[model samples]
Target: MDAIEKNLLKEVAELDSLPVGAYNIRANGQLAGRNTTANIDIVTKTDKPGIDIYIRPFTKNESVHIPVILSQTGLKDLVYNDFHIGEGADVTIIAGCGIHNCGGGNAEHDGIHTFWLAKNAKLRYVEKHYGEGDGRGKQIMNPTTIVHLAEGAEMEMETTQIAGVDDTIRKTGGDLAEGASLVVKEKIMTTGDQHAVTDFNVDLNGEGCSANIVSRSVAKDESKQEFISHINGNCACAGHSECDAIIMDHASVIASPALTANSVDASLIHEAAIGKIAGEQLIKLMTLGLTEKEAEDQIVNGFLK
Candidate 1:
């Protein structure tokens, strides 16, 4: 990997070197590196631009890293990756994309990831998106994720958009069976004239199933952000969605949450809060030898953390 690609990997996945266990690195729309363990397999698709990962049953304490980097000008890349986790397995997946465009044309990457979890399986997935360059070209990314959980399966997802993407749209959907659970937490920050939108749709389709989705964001300068979530409970289940954001310096944010309960025993709730930083917060921080901007940044960092 080149220096640019390595830097991108660090920023997106925090990998300073080749990681142990199963891993795949994609750079400039091509596979840069790959490794697979005995219990985990990674195979490239013959008909499309993507890979499929399979984990053996009863696997535990394993991880996979699949990070994508785009450092070319005027490049448009799209990929579809799918993961099949076996029964009674527990593992972690780290995936993300970073773009460094240095030309006068737009550079964009769109990725679609689907996950299937078998009965009694558990998965922890983390994904981050970042963009940077001193160029007139725009950096754009759109990611779509779909998840299916079997009986007693569980999944926890953490997604973050760190900085510098000019435009982004994120979509996540899930379906849960009996006794299954899904939890999604997202964080995003947009500045300048960037625009960001997130959409989440989840269905709790069996008894005792549950889904929780939460998002925290900061919109600065002329950036605009929108958060939309819809959760449906088809049986005796629980669902909750929350969106919290801080608006600053002509920025705008909108949050819309909807829930549908088809069974009498289903429980659903939604919450949203959008506001600016409190003056008292800045005053308190400033009294401790910090500038106004420093105080604001500190507060924002702590809030996002």
Candidate 2:
């Protein structure tokens, strides 16, 4: 192996030896010094399951970027995983998981992620979770993500969840500091006999802090989806939250979006809607020579676009 490859393997071995809990990435040779910058790419073996990751700044003013990819081959249960982003540093992280297992057995996965954006820092995170059909009874996933922003810091987070075997529950939230801002967007799609729930909460704790949340979900067959979003302004902050869902063919959806402002100077607004696709649009597409299924698919594709 090359020098870099050997070093990386050594680091991974060291991390594997640590106890199961939160530990700084620096301890594993994944982090550079404070005020420096580093990039990390991770690809795990198929079906290995459990992994716990913690990211923290070695010193103030550091910057780090991480990209992670997961494959479904040899899939096993992922009991718990954690991600931590430290204060006073900028971090950009991208993560995605896909299941390609063809066996007919149930699976369960859970994850917890935390972000601490210090003063004058920033964080941008994007995550996609998807599962493939295996004719299994139940496949469950529960994920929770939390973010804390300090003065002048900002966070931008986006998530996409696509249904696979059975039921999935995902929860995410964050707190914004003075002059900080947070923007979150989520998209969910499900089919078959699946059940999914997504929850989001945002707190604006300092003056001039703001937040924006947008969520959309689509369910088909006997599937069910629920979306809940809340935005709270504790001091003098301003923000808005919007949620909408589309249901079809015996599918059901529930949407709840709320905005609360504790101080008079704070301004918050929220809106939520749940319904099916407009029949007129479908009919129009069908008249264009598309089959019923094709028209429906077109509408869904357009909605997500």
Q: Could you estimate the TM-score for every candidate?
A: 0.99, 0.75
- Computed on alpha carbons, the lDDT of every model, listed in order, comes to 0.95, 0.64
- Superposed on all Cα atoms, model 2 deviates from the true structure by an RMSD in Å of 8.4
Candidate 1: pairs in clash = none
TM-score of 2: 0.75
Error of 2 at 60 (Å): 14
Model 2 lDDT per residue over 1-305, tens place = 23433333233222223222222222111222122223222222245433333345533333332222122233344423334444555655554443333455554545566666667667777666655545643556677888888888888887777556367778888888899989888888889878888888888898999898888778899998888878888999988888877889999888877777788999998887788888898899999999989999888877765
Error of 1 at 258 (Å): 0.6
